[model samples]
Target: MNPVIHFEMPYEDRERMAAFYRSAFGWQTQMLGPEMGNYVLATTTETETGDRGPTQPGAINGGFYGKHPDWPAQHPSVVIGVDDIRAAMEKVSASGGQVLGEPMEIPGVGHYVSFMDPEGNRVSMLQPLPRG
Candidate 1:
């Protein structure tokens, strides 16, 4: 079964949000630049070697994206990991969920895409790059 691997939330003030998470939950935050759309990576748990993910099984990490007025459903969402993005998109469509658009490569990460479930909740999927 596909697992929920990551999460995302919209932030109006990147620093403020980062500080809040850092202070309240002790999460480590890494702020990305404009090329990455000012995304903030949040590490909520101890990671394994190479920082792939949490060392503890089932523990997921998440991020924060800059909120924009043009974006729809700017709410917190979870990201599921899939083996094949195209197949997952097909399943989402078949299940009555709407795939927002074609998946985009996330540099050293993987192909990623967002969708809106039948209930109008925004969620995402990631096809991670192969581990060496």
Candidate 2:
């Protein structure tokens, strides 16, 4: 699954958030998507080089955030890549999780939803569409 797990923090300041991360870890965010509304992905290569593999070759991992997320703080969501959102959601329900919002589109990205796990962990999931 392409799970987009997020770290929740106060302050909707992406720039300051960027600076903090940049200083602490030497990483940066690259704005993505149309509107660029709250969409920022972080990248870095700090540790000793291991096997160095991208999920999809050139695909970079370890994203960061230094601003407000599109979703609310209580609804903090971490996405899991799945072949089927409907099926995955169904599994979420069967597993005692409650779906919170309507499945929404990220325009060019894909679909997403917020849900609470059986244990009441506020989390979210995303399914990014494949490149044409």
Model 1, 56-91: lDDT tens digits are: 998999999998898889999999999999999999
In candidate 2, position 100 carries an lDDT of 79
For candidate 2, the 10 contiguous residues with the lowest summed lDDT are 46-55
Best model number under TM-score: 1
Per-prediction TM-score: 0.97, 0.66
Count of backbone clashes, every candidate in sequence? 0, 10
Quote the lDDT for 68 in model 1.
88
- Each candidate's root-mean-square deviation in Å? 0.7, 5.5
TM-score of the candidate numbered 1? 0.97
